[model samples]
Target chain A: MTSANSARRRKPFPVHILVFLAPAFIIYTLFMIYPLLDSLRLSLYAPDVNRQEVFVGLDNYERLMTNDLWQPRIEGAIKNNLVFFAIHMLVQNPIGLMLAALLSSQFIRGRAIYRTLIFTPTVLSVVLVGFIWRMILSPLWGISTDFLDLFGLAAYDKPWLGLEETALPTLSLISVWQWVGIPMMLFLAALISIPDELIEAARVDGATAWGVFWRIRFRLIMPTVGIVGVLTFVGNFNAFDLIYTTQKATAGPNYSTDILGTFFYRTFFGVQLQPGNPTMGATVAGVMFLIILAGVLLYMFGWQRRMLQVEF
Target chain B: MKKLLALAVILTLVVALVPATTQAQDKVTLTIESWRNDDIAFWNDVLIPAFNAHYPDIEVIFAPAAPTEYNAALNAKLEGGTAGDLITCRPFDLSLEHFNNGYLVSLNDLPGMEHFGPVARSAWITDDGSDVFCVPMASVIHGFIYNQSIFEELGLEEPATEPEFLELLDAIKADGTYAPLSMGTVDLWEAATMGYQNIGPNYWKGEEGRLGLIDGTIGYDENGFVEAFEALARWTPYLPDGYQAISYPDSQNLFTLGMAAIFPAGSWEIGVFRGQDPDFEMGAFKPPVPEGADTCYISDHVDIAMGVNAASQHQEEAMLFMEWMTTQEFAELYSNALPGFFTLSDHAITLEDPLAQEFLSWRDECESTIRSSYQILSRGEPNNETQLWEVSAQVLNGELTPQEAADIVQSGLEAWYEPQQQ
Candidate 1:
């Protein structure tokens, strides 16, 4: 009787646990896990000249890395994708942090209104944002020129969205404008969660506002920073909409704005008269997965492992 | 009282359903799946009524998806056996893919197939030319569309030669009353579709060059292609200020708003132009031939067509409608209703839109060719169509010399194209 009781106690299995997990597990498996595994499997094979799916393990990767036709495009897309991520990290995160810092301050006026106004673009459809921005920046009919003229900067105005050098960076800024609210809200939540005693103790030590932010608040929110960084990395690497909307699938002006997502799309669905190659597309997707996986793993193992989460 | 009311309700229900059940049997309904959603009103109000005039029993429904989503959506519907009987065919490999996959049936034995010549049917034919899958509906001609008032204001005449064309643009730019060219590279296709393909045929010698490319006798780096790029390069100076940032719609607005003079355009823009500004006087001129060239070339590319879905239950009714499409009445109706979309039928229907008529008149005055890249060359990596857009844009942007642009396309083609390998 004791053994039976102990066995039951040790098991600690509640049948309700599975009952609770069943719906989510089944849905995630069907939608996410299955497609991901299948796509990974597809990367290992390609259609032969006779259109038969034949095992050609690592050949697609080899070609993607080395073939004259594909290598440059892959390299270009990766390079552009890195630039895209860098822009987010360098510009978006810092601005978001600043906004959160400002909004959290006791001196700021109408903080709620400012927060709502800043966050308004985040809820707008990406397509609508792209369309509206395209019109606003249009050289022929755009009001951007007039806006610049008001600042005595009319001569500096160029088709920032149209040029090869400017297209990606300009798009990055536009994306930043649309998505800044996410990181801002995240940082705000993190700031609010910080225990008041720690901050009050720092204030008692006569720490300046800047010193408090850098030494106390920023250090305590390191975990959130890591999360936001990983999220931005994953999001920016997979981004397609704004670029696809603005530059098209070609990633035009000599493919200055081509990212892995657009590249994968063009490969999978083809563009113009070029027929889609599913196997090759899967290979591109496989590379993208590797890129995002590496970033995530680095965050989890490298960054998060070292981040000291402050206890209340 | 309850029994009497129940009985009365049953009788009325039977009466209502009686006609519906009978009508469902003898009346065959045909749906045409098309990307031309803009023409739904025309199809319903004008073309369908005309089609109904001959076969009153056959009911036609004009079902369409957004142009960009049509291909994927149609394929999905086809896979599920729920597609329309008649499918609007995108030209070249896209339709050819359908036939190969058995989504579209061979229309080789259709009686009306005789009405189309090989050129009109080329877009839908099999690789070995054994089967024609779609009936060609229309082809859009590429040319220069200009504001008639702007031309008059500048005292400019339609140029017949490349030198004269440049001179006219120079005159307009000098006057500074309007932007000389209202085109942009932001939408890369405009550079290729309206610019390179529009004028490339002149330098490449039309069908001779196109057939040569198909036959593996021509190289993109050759004089013809390079010269076309050179001509495209010269167009940069006259383009609208800050042209690089301009998009297709922006360029259209510029032209329509009378801030720009000339728009390199496909004939399909006629309806759009008219729709936007009913009183806007527009004139189209054929792509000017280079100096000392006796034969002028124009791109009269097949744009759209209709095919029978192999899985559709009502193939007979669909074929009947397709047959009627080849008739003179349908041709006249289609051409008049959709002014810019000229019918592929042999019937020489008069166009009411002067700009559209002007575009059609080029067929008589010049040699006609499809976009050189569309048929087969675009099937592989470094797609000719896409490459043309990028290279043409780069060349116009002065980022690449014409020679470099030509070389890029040639080498890119050589990478995969078996013929270009040599």
Candidate 2:
């Protein structure tokens, strides 16, 4: 120990700390925390014709789970969401990871050009992306069909964005196309950060390039994969703008594309026949929050700690 | 004596100048909300300019919303306490609830109340003859729009009777030139609108017909509504194949491209159709009411109205703007811009379109045409119209017989109101 360091450092005053934190704390409380708590309180009630709300704790929740009109809608939305997420995981992330690995490789050409082009869609507003896709897929426009005919798969051409069976999957593909860049960049950073010495050492030990990548590079990036998965799970559930901009509240031919967000919108504001019901709307919102919370908790407890926790 | 004279002069100046300055300061600003772009242009170009010229002190603002987003956005604004000073709405909106809550001022004794034509005024007035809750701006007549050139080419005259109409439809089909009517039922309401138009003539049969089905005095399974449904069902064979899968724009295209002889739609489409095909010779008539009825020509416009907001600080300014809106000048402005719509004002203007001219001439000769009941169903209660849509779709799909579909409508309405009872 150095004998010259004799003075002790004092802890900062609590008031000084509070002064530094107050503005952000106040803003967060007002906008986020209070509104969330208020919504949870509101979900316990039901609307009456007199514009008064009556308390009916958990009855809304119960009815949502079991009611004929509502239960099926909820189940359908969940299934659609899961399918949407799975497609992204299967198609988007793996493609992104491969591209990232290739881009990080020393021999790749025009890396900057590819990166710029791939990341361009991510910067666009979801509404613009939806409208652009809708126009491209329009039968009247015939661009999509014309493109497929070049590959001699003209017979396989479909009104993929319009039909009941293909609409949701097409929308998911669109979402994946827009968002793949985010994970690609994350993987690219992780890939690049691997020290050159480690790969050199493996190569000197008579390892092949593929062997070096699997043994050293892939293992080092397990933490990034975990982060990406959690990000994807959260994003899938919170999605509203793409579906809303494309489908409107009715969500197409027989409500095929209706999701929890549109459901909440219709219930809260009502449509041509149903009057607006705020409490029910709040209940839907509350349930959505709970669903997202449960997802995040699962990610933290099951995946994040296990994969990312480094052992010395 | 000189000092006292100066004080009196200063006092007189203060008294005279104070009110004029205050009145200038109190110049009220009022806003009107609507989703119709054309109507917004009319307000900006014609109504506002005229009103401002009349009352230079008052300022008027126009806030237009997109069509699909209008209702939901308006409701959110109302609930969130940010609605405009004057809201553009239809009669069937829950304005009655707003009136009961004292959000809407009673227009009973408002200046120019007596000028509101009966058809225009009937929607906003209370059933008990208490007060006028809204001011109607225009009346829309709903019926079949047919290509006149096509009918003429086939040597078919416009049908004036139900059997003649069926004959005319078959003749068009036999000619193989066109389908009878092109329709889309994807949204559920198109079929219901068609059903209402078909049922309108039967409505005047007193308590035995349409009224009984609606008010629950007689069950929907009653013979009259069943006949009405069957009448609607007759058109099914004439409709395009895969009609259920088609959207509104697709159906509109079918008609505009002359794929069908007729389209069961609102006269509002007269502008839209003409815009698409300037030479598309088209004419409309009340779908022939039954052979012998008290009111044979039954066609009415759905009500689109304007109201003063409850929270409006400038009620006088809003009312003044509304009063000018229903005047003859404003009426002609709207009529010239969008033909086939009759303004609320009693005065008339000459329409250049031969079909529009014919509609007006027919209305002039026939005074007792019953309005379309679809409009009533639209503004009445929620699910009432939706039930009609669902039942109509069921009827079209063959899952339910006509009478069963009627029963479903009745039961659906009953279920909707039952929650209120609890």
Candidate 3:
């Protein structure tokens, strides 16, 4: 009887744990891992003269890196993706952090209302956001121009989405506007989670309001910042819908706004007059996967190791 | 055991009668997938009724997708082995790719294929000329659709020569009353339609220029293509400010609303143009050629072609529908539905719309050779049409010279061809 009791106490290989996990595990494997592995496998082959898929083994990757037709587009897309991430980090995160700090203060009234209003845009569809912005900024409609005119800056109004020099930056800023709410909410949660005693102590020690944030609250929320940064990085690299909806698959006005996501889309699905090659498309996806994986690894090992957790 | 055996016999009898009952009904549904969502009314009001009247046993279902999304969706469906019985085939590389993949059923043995002219048939004929894959539906003539009132008000006649066209653009620019061209480069394909299709054939004429491209003997940087880009560049100044930001529909609005003088578009847009402005008087003209060119070439090609899916279970019914599409009744219905689209029927159909009549007049004149757009002639690797469109945009934006634009296209072509040669 003691042996049987001990055996029960030992967990009996935890078969029920697997039973609980089986559904989610099967779903994740079937939808996520299977498609990813299949795409990776597809990257090794290429279409021949007869349009038959023939195994070329790393040839698609080699061509993507070295071939004149694809290399420029791939490199340009990667460069744009980096810029996209950087803009979100520099402009979006800082602004979001500032907003969160302001909203999280004890003195601030109607904090819930402010939070709801700010977070509303994040819930709105990207397509709706893109269309609204496109119309607002349209040179033909004069909505943006009229708004600028109110501030005596009508001369500055140009086709911001059309010009090659301004297109990518304009698109980035638009994206930042829509998504800034996400980081704001995250930072707000992190700020609220911080023990109020630490901040009170900092204030009692003759620290300024700014000093409290800089010395206490900011440091405690570094983990959230790291999480937000990694999330932004992954999200920016995977972005396609906004640019596609607004600028199209060409990422046009001479592909000035072309990024990795749009590039991957074009390479995989193709657009007007261009035929899609699944192998090449898969190769682009694999490359993007590696790039995202590198960014994640860098965060996990490099940044995460250096980050010291603060205990209250 | 006796009861179980009796039940099994009854079940077998019921199962066996089901097929016979279905056969007695003799109902076969045929699905046709096409990009002509705008023609849904015609399909419902005309084609379906006519088809049902002739053969009530076969029911036709028209599955329409938007032009932009059709190819990719159809490709996915075909690859997954779940495509429609009758599939719409795009001209050029897409159709060729489908044929090469053995996804298309040959229409060579189908009756009424002879109604299609050699040019129409050529669009769907296999690379090896072994079989024709699709039935040609309609031929679209591409050129400039100009505001008749705007032209009259400005005293601008139809420019018959390249120099005259440039002169007319200058006059319109100087007048400053309206944009000389309603160009929507935001779509990108518009630039190709204007730069390559409307102009390239004027430079690259005859079998030598056409076949030379496939053989790589005639490069895009040659004088012919250079002149084409140069011509497109010359019109840049006359385009609306921020034309690159304009979408296709908005540009058409510009033309129809008299904000712009001209819209470079296909003949198929006539219906939409008329629908937009009932009283608007629009005139069609073939884009003029350079001074020394022997004959002007108009960009004309088969618009929508129908092909049977190789994996279709009901191909005979699908083929019957396709055969009926070639009949005079169907042709009249199509022409009546879409007024401006030219059909491939030996039986003459009268064009009622004045603008369509004007376009047909050009066809009857025979002074111009009808050529497929450069987009259709070129294969879809290194994406020549897209490359040309990009370069043209750059040229218009003053970032690249016309020569540089031509060179960029040539380089792209070389990149595509050199690898294939290896």
Candidate 4:
């Protein structure tokens, strides 16, 4: 060990580091970077009248941006995607934070059971979740009406999954329910890592429980909050399976529930009657990539300055 | 030079003939790829055994993928050069693209191609009508499947006109014993398929309106198309309570379980209805014509076909099987076994099931046409079929008026279809 260290004391250049990184680098490149670049390349070409692909020099993107056929669809998808992301930030994350804060309390009983129960839905497949929720909201089979009647709210028992106004929100809530566990677990980990002595010291300094949480515990866990937010931003933007599974490929009720992911899938793979358009599909995918990249960069540069971890 | 030429000719002949002779001597296996996983037993137990009795040397395998994944899976298999000798085709553009890519061989010169008429061959033929790729296997006719027991108990006769149809529906609703119509807008396609297309043929005059729309001679906002939407809108009151949330399966169950009196259906659903219960007798009736109209039209849509893979190693054996499919015996076997999928060939076969026979009898009673959005209109940005599904469902949901629904369809078409721009 001494000899190896002495050999590269001034310069830490080493062949072993490259060897160690080879597996991950090769995997990430082949699976992630290569296909992404290829898809980007594919987005630049369009099929002419002869059905042969030709280099169109951003004509595909131009059509997607300006043409009457795609402009509204893309706009609607972006608008819906914003709504989807907002729901996660506004509803999912806050509930997760509250659950974590409560579960972390010393006086709370059955913490493990509550934690496991909340986490169970996260482990279930999105397909199963969509199926179960669709049934639960279904007027014919679901107990939603009966359940509502118990609270004298039977008048509110309209089909949430079928109506245009409520369909997107219903799906969003289903997604939030399945995913709230993630942020809770993350916040819980960060909260437990907090030194008990520090909290005790704050109490000795005549701090209320609420004051200690806001000024001490929450301040210490700010980095986790940033991580949770960004994670949700990425996840919500890429969501397709739940909506697709619940509302078929057309995302019906006049496309009211369509988001960026379902829009891309419909454009790419098509449903019953329409055929796939690979070039245009690739263009949508490229736009998705840019949107995600811009978001990550924004979060990194503007949202948080430091990610100081609590180490003991 | 002459001697050398003769020797080269002899060598080439032997090389070609040797493989042919070797292949003929050994038993050959031909695998078929299909999306009809539901009919696996029908293919294996009835059709394969019958085919083997005639051609004992060739063994056949029936392989299928889930219907939803068939297109992507089939493309991957074809690209990898591992697709089966026989390929089951989805109608129109799906199979047409395969022919364009040289995945399927042009079966124009094949002997049994003459048995099919232009109407049957229209689905798998080239746009210019020079080449036919797939052998037309089956078509599903559109009509109404109703509960016979309920109809008998209510003393309701089959309605022959639109006014009578609505009157019967009113009577059923007044009775309060059963839901008048078993249909839903949740799946969207069910609305377009079983509701709009079922009744629209009488309003649009079928082929003329469909062609006019394609040529831009007819806009969807016109009387024919608008009236179709009006018909769908009219059905709103007769539908089951909470029909907006009811899915395709839910609608089917409502009829099958005797909760609903009538189900707008395709000929494809006959098998499912037959298996429900022995006591539940199902009845079929053609879509009622307009009040003053004399002629009636039906949507006899071509749904499935079979084609040979151009890259198959055993094209000769596969072509033999294709030739046999055109025979009368195969037609009788396929129609009786499948029940709902009426064989496309004009073999004058008898249907054993009363409901299927009744559905088939409408072909002679009405002029036959296909779904309006199927052919050339659906290849663009907002798929015409997909648009119809949305508008038709919304019309039933009361989200859009009939005129607004028609305008949405018309504009969606004009955005891409050139003739519609006028």
Candidate 5:
């Protein structure tokens, strides 16, 4: 009878559970949720002639989409962001997967050393990476040109970072080089988590090594792949530091390297001769937030549904 | 016993509060914000000490931001109501914008302003020429700095006309020993500063042309600007191959290393050039005009000016510092520290540096006019400085003709102006 009474008392509302969740909830609300909501609120206002913020109610967003000075830049940034994401998905992820596969293999020697060397760039500051790459690629110094001349490919050498056609792709590739380590490490962990006995079973049943990898290992790592894809998408869309450090706040050579991150920065802070408008900047941020939210929802609902958790 | 304890606490509070209030009254710190990060040492060692020598009760702090990031940071600080006591003021639109937004304090009744001449005073004055918003610091003259050794080696003289200048560039190019011009358009502003701002005035015919532009009586597609664009295009061939990939610092490196013959820059760069190569003998020449023009007009304008922040807690102290800054003593020190920067004071501060003397000579010899750099005269809508840089870079890259570039600028100006009219 005493036990039944204790059970019916509802465990005193689980004070310990509340205690555990409180810190994280407070932090998340203070840092992330408050700022996000503030930005959304700010998007509804515009600066008047006196530079005082006044509530304009959707005018900023409408102007951002329709204004001559802003519309093209927004569209261009969105397009560049897609290209940036596509490059990572196609090039960075595949290379990471291949490297992970090789490094995780039992036959490969010095796998640990290779892993350490590859991940070194990921730990370096983005500013340092951008500056170092800019110096190495500078045509004035002739470092890149000299390097290319050694293989008799001097004709192919140009100011890749300065040219309008090549600047964005070149920057994207540099970003890929720095970040490929993240996906590689994730894939390597996923690969290691798979029981070796399953592979052995597949091989013993007359399956080749490639077939074992294709049918067994790849199938087991779909969940990790989905996570990596979503992470890459989010990171690519939110990218700013690298482009800003390299090309400056203008994102120029005629704004070829412009992405949503740079666009948002320029709108918020202004660059060169462009004066900042906080209202428009907040509007841009709100749009970006919505886009990212949609992407996250799609991943959770559609991709997560198909991703089966592999049991050991 | 409780009453006794409360009395003890009250006595302790009184003792603490008295000294705190006295200390606050005895000393004040005035913060000065500027974009001249390179001049921190000068401010720390020289200016601060000089200012403190007079007003020992007030301490001065020199806060600096990089030139590229200065405006944005300053705007943020102003918006947050936390800007410094004294603020550096850019000429024209930026200053006007800040004034309109009530970020600056009017200095119409400030002392030492009488020392400023008509030109220096007019720079900070309102459009109606009644109120002054800032105290003028120094006027910088823009021209080409050439390697004296290279000119001696090549037996070249400072050209006095546009044709002569082009001829000199041609000769230098034909020599093939060094780049004729050390200019990097990669930063985009280099071309605008070197070619447009320095040389454009000579083509535009100075103040008359600028006034016409401001009043909408003239356009960028007019004959003067077209000629200026042509002159800029003419200099492109003398630039090094892959010049667009070379940054401003790299271009300076080339000039200092003797890889280039000429560098077009403002007088503010004299100290920089000297620091890079102490023994590097360089000579200055004002941008030459067409042979039949009235006179070669040199680009002269106040480069660094200071104003008191309206929201500052120490307005009286800031005004004191600014008044001290405008004195002849400060002028001499400033000119001594940065050789070629001419003081705004009508008082004759003797020039020690040969380069400063030469620039002074140029000023005396030609019709010196206020520099009408794109932002200096615009309505702040077209952002013509940025447009000029972009179009100038395109011209250098051979992607656009001078005419096409002129048309682009004209269209931008029209787009900005049409809306204002409506």
Candidate 6:
């Protein structure tokens, strides 16, 4: 009798709890969880004779890391991915930080207009963005040269998108243009959240405005900075859409811009020149997953501690 | 306990009801997955209306995905076992594997294959001749489309031989009014298609030569293909400035707007040129072969085709749609929309564009032998297009010597075929 009574009296979940959780749970599970789990399951098997997928243990990963045709692609992709991520960290984040600092200044007028204008690009679809930039940079149209010539920078311009040496970096800058707004908004939010009294206290101690910002505001926003850094790392590692849109899966100019995303796509779907190999694709995706996981772990364990502040 | 009971009931009911709801009966929908290139506007404005008028029972939906997206989405659907009932199969589509996977129906068994031309049937039929995977939708011919008005103004007669062609181009270039020829290399295949299609089979083995290529008797660097590339590379001096950076539409625009004298393209561009400049005096001609070459006709290959999904519930309706699509009555309807698209159905219809009509007449009058595009060759074997793509780009960029490119293609073929010899 006591057991039955205890079971019946167990903590009640209100009707609203079910109502609130049901929709989200169904969406997340159906869209995200199922596909993820299915992909993971598919990674375990390799296709064999009779075109049937048979269990192959870790052979797919082994072949991908050690095979002649595939090994170079994997190493090249990793090196290219690191280079891409580094460029974004050095160029994109700094530009975004500078823009945020400038926009958040107290004397800046029409801040809302500037913010909206800057954010508008990030809202555009990557395909539309790619086409727009392609047209602007086209030598056929000469719009980019004409526009640059008005500012007397015509000498600085070339067919930047077509050259092998400049293609990846040019694409990176284009990406930076589109995505800078996101980090800028993050920095802006963080900047606004810093207590003004801390800066005032620093100023009262004979600190200059720049010193006050550095000593107080910057320290307080270290957690936000760390978060932005981690976000950038994850985002760059998973980057596929922009490169796919601009360069196709091959990431052209003789594949000089072939990063991990393009490599994964080409392996997964196969192109005109190759047959689609699912095992190879899964291996590439698995490597990408490990890379992202590692970056996230570093942020969570190592950087998280450094960003922590204790109040006296 | 009550809350848990409610949660369990809700979950059970949802899972149970999902299957309980059968596909709504008496509903028939046919989706054609096509690209957003030349066919998009025509399908929307003309094809859909004509189709709907003929068969009110079935709704035709033009669900366009761009080329890359279309391929990926189609592959996923095929892999997921939910591909469209009618899908566009490009020249390089991996549909052979899709057919093997039981994704496509045997289109040969469909009701009306007798009406199609031999080339059309051959393009889509299985190698064993037991089944047809698709019905050729229309033919795409690759050749030089010239501005007739510009030629007339320059007093340049169409060249009848290789030397005559070179002399004409050199004269045009020397006059300084326009470049002799222009092509966009951004697509990577435009140059090769121009070179290979017209001359490949001639140098190859006539019809037997092509068969040899297929059966591995002839090698990839078969002297014929190399000869074609070498002849094509000589024209680089006459092409437009920054030719490598040019894209497809930009080249079309250049030809249409009189920025250039000639544009190399498939016959599909006739409608675009007509739309862009109705008064433009444009006509298509077969590119001249090198001196003493056996082939003279422009290569016209079967283009996009229709096929029924094997797994479709409405197989009968889908088959009916495909048969109806290829008839003379339907051909007339399509011709009314997209002029310059050729048909073997012998449709007696008035064309919208006179220039297109002239080109069609010329095609009919000239008994010149034609060949298939390189796409057809590469489609049968893996990495055919890849090797071709790289070599074409290298030839254009002058990065690879002609002999080197030939050796590369030969090695590529050996990698795929040599193992079979053992």
> For this target, which candidate reaches the highest DockQ against the unseen true structure?
4
Predicted candidate 4 versus true structure: per-residue lDDT over A206-258, tens digit per residue: 99999999999998888889999999989988889999998988886678889
Give one digit per residue, the lDDT tens place, for model 6 in B1-422: 23336545544543564343335456577767666565777787787777777787787767677665556566665665455678676543365556766888877666667777555565666666577687666665566678887899899887756678789889889888886787755556665665555545445534555556656676656576677677667777887766656666777777777878877666677877778887877766666655776544445566667677776767887888888876776777666566667654544555666655655554453322234323235542336666676677667666667778777776656555543232
Docking model 1 quality class:
medium
lDDT of 5 by residue, A47-162 (tens): 78777899999898888889877788889999999999999999999999999999999999999999999999999999999988889988777588889999999889888787
What overall lDDT, based on C-alpha atoms, would model 5 receive against the true structure?
0.83
* Candidate 2 colliding pairs: A273-B382, A273-B383, B92-B379, B140-B301, B300-B372
Distance from true location, Cα of A124 in model 4, Å: 0.7
TM-score of each: 0.92, 0.76, 0.88, 0.91, 0.88, 0.78
| Model 3 interface CAPRI class | medium
Query: Model 5, B291-323: lDDT tens per residue?
Result: 788688887767778999999888899999989
- Residue-level error in angstroms, candidate 4, position B230: 1.0
lDDT of 1 by residue, B62-158 (tens): 9788897677677766765667789999998878988999999988998877888777887999978999999889999899999999888778899
**Best TM-score among the predictions, by candidate number:** 1
Ranking by DockQ: 4, 1, 3, 5, 2, 6
Model 3: per-residue lDDT, tens digit, A26-118?
A: 999987998899899999998887768899999999999998778898999999889988999999999999999999988999999988988
- Model 1: DockQ score: 0.68
Q: Which clashing pairs does model 3 show?
A: none
For each model, chain A TM-score?
0.95, 0.92, 0.96, 0.94, 0.95, 0.89
Q: What 10-residue stretch in candidate 1 chain B is worst by lDDT?
A: B1-10
lDDT of 5 at B84: 78
How does candidate 3 score on lDDT? 0.80
- Which regions of candidate 6 are displaced past 4 Å? A1-27, A66-69, A151-156, A204-210, A213-216, A270-279, A309-312, B1-118, B129-137, B161-167, B175-179, B194-209, B304-337, B344-382, B417-422
- Which tens-of-lDDT digit does each residue in B277-323 have in candidate 3? 78888897887879977677766656678899998878888888889
Q: Rank the candidates by lDDT, best first.
A: 1, 4, 5, 3, 6, 2
**Residue-pair clashes per candidate, as listed?**
0, 5, 0, 0, 0, 1
DockQ scores of the candidates: 0.68, 0.25, 0.57, 0.70, 0.51, 0.20
Cα TM-score of candidate 4: 0.91
| Shift in Å, residue B365, candidate 1 | 1.2
